[model samples]
Target: MKNQKAVLVILLSNVFIAFLGIGLIIPVMPSFMNIMHLSGATMGYLVAMFAVAQLVMSPFAGRWVDRFGRKKIIILGLFLFGVSELIFGLGESVPVLYLSRILGGFSAAFIMPGVTAYVADITSLKDRPKAMGYVSAAISTGFIIGPGIGGFIGEYGVRLPFFFAAGIAFAACILSAFILKEPLSKEKLAELANNQAQSNFFYDLKKSLRPLYFIAFLIVFVLAFGLSAYETVFSLFSDHKFGFTPKDIAGIITISSIFGVIFQLFLFGKLIDLLGEKKLIQLCLIVGAVSAFLSAVISGYFAVLAVTCFVFLAFDLLRPALTTFLSKAAGEEQGFVAGMNSTYTSLGNIVGPAIGGILFDVNIHYPYLFSGVVIIVGLLITVIWKEKQFSQSLAK
Candidate 1:
């Protein structure tokens, strides 16, 4: 138990560093677009390209994690992440940027599923919610710190943030190479090995993820889709609508990240215990939809900021709640389920940015309006979802 706890700490640190590297690039993306003289649609495609690569690779990555162990996959992912960021920092042309995003997506496919499965391997069912909460908090913390730091560093140059992110990711890769150990028990490892040996990846994946699990995956997709649509073009919207610079955008994101960290670390577990995952998910979806809608119509900076805070808080609450629910329903296929979750997320990311970019070209308000509508549809699905099987599985 003590050993598991120790490993969990290391896993949490890795997630923090990984997310930090990713977040460092967010605030600078608009600047990069400007430097390249890219259109809104082009920018959206650039963002989506990363997820496109991730969607293609996630299924295979998940299977490999279960087969090869988590540590090895994480190391490889971090190395790729560092290389991709470095390429983006140094690249001179649009094709090189696309290549960078492709590598970044591939890196995400490995890192996200591996970290999720690693957490599941080490934590007990009762402790899983809190563990997931901590993981979310770590991710939020990275995002919280990343943009502010990135913005400050970006004062030097747009490419500086990417280079800085590369440095952090490379350092994390080295740290993880030495510190991270496989968290699965020998019995559990043998079970996974035997399962892999008996069946092919697709067969096992299809068999493991039941119908209810598909619904869970769908929910994750909708959440990611809406959020990505809003996020991918957010800086563009703010810059156009409010005459905000990169520094101002960075400040807004920093505030949002602060609220996200607070909610994830302190309120998420308590809220889950109070409302249950079903009710919590439903409530958050409604909140997200309303906030997105309000942000679209509102005029002033403060009103926008206030509404966005609610949006960020809702997203923060929803992530850990939904992840815990999915992890509970995963049964013995933790790695595969986590991979599927990442796959669905990547799909949303791909579609969301593509749609958002086109909409942004037409009208600045369209992306937020579209995001709100999609989230409402997601809410309706969640409201009608039959959770009996999910509940029964979690009870075990």
Candidate 2:
């Protein structure tokens, strides 16, 4: 038990540092565009490129995690993450930025699934939700801290945050290399290897494509799609619409992340127990859709802030609830399932920003409006889903 707790802390800390690097660049994106003389579509592509790399790499990364062990992959990913951030910080050309983003995506593909699967390996089924909550809170807390710190540093220079994030990621890499231990035992690894020898990747993937798993993937895609669209154009929108600076954008994201952290830490586990994952997911989807739509039309900074807080809160609750649902259903394929989860998320990130960027060219509000409508569709799909049907399908 003590060993498990120790592993969890190390995993959580590594994840926090990794995500903080990602978030640190968010507020300063406008500056990046200006410096690079990029268009909206170009910037969108830059953001989407990271997910594109992740989408392509995640399935394979998942298999590797299960085969090789989590600790090695995590350390390698963190080191590469630091390198990517450093490249972005130092690069002067658009091509270099693209290269950096692609590397970042690959790093995320390894890190996200490894961390999630590691958590599942260390935790019991009954305690999984709570453990997942802490992981989610750790991620949210990084975003909470990243933007505030990045915004402050960004005042000096836009590239400064990237350098700072690079240093942090490298520090995490060193810490994880020394402290993080593999969760699986030698006997368990031998068993899994023997099982793998008998079966194959295609066969395992086919088994994992159960109805509930499909629903979980769809939910992740919808959630990521909506959020990415909103986030991709947010700084630009605020700047154009309200004359807000990077500092203002950072402040808003910081506030929203605080709400997300609070929900993930204090309310998410209890809510999962109370309403159940299905019910809570449905509720959050509805709230996310409404809040996103309201954010588009709302006037006043405070009103927008309030609406966005609800959006963040809904998203925060939905992530762990859905992750818990999927992890419970993953059976022995925790790494593969987590990889697929990252794939779906990457797919959403890819499509959302591409479409959102094009729409932002037409009108800034269009992206948010489109996000709300798409989420509404996701809500409808959730409503029509039947758990009994999923269970029967899986039983086969």
Q: How does model 1 fare in lDDT?
A: 0.86
Taking all chains together, each candidate's TM-score versus the true structure is: 0.96, 0.95
Q: Give the whole-model CA lDDT for all candidates, comma-separated.
A: 0.86, 0.86
Error of 2 at 79 (Å): 1.2
Return the TM-score for candidate 1, rounded to 2 decimals: 0.96
For model 2, the local distance difference test gives 0.86
| Candidate 2 lDDT, 1-396, residue by residue in tens | 988888888899998998888788878988878888888888789889988999988878887778788887888899989999999999999899999999999999999888999999989889999999998888888888888888888989999999999999999999988888788887876776666666555765575566758777888998889888888888888877888778888888889989888888888888987988888999999999999889788877888778878988888888888888888887777877888898889999999998889899898899999999989888987876797865553343
lDDT for each residue of candidate 1 in 1-396, tens digit (9 for 90 to 100): 888888888888878887888778777777888888999998899889999999889988888888788998898899999999999999999999999999999999999789989998788888899899898888888887888888888888889989888888899889888888877766777778778777665775575456657667788999999999999888889888998777787788778888888888788888888998888999999999999999888987778778878998888888888899889888778887888888889989999999999999999999999999999989988866777866775765
Which stretch of 10 consecutive residues in model 2 shows the poorest summed lDDT? 387-396
Candidate 1: residue 116 Cα off by (Å): 0.9
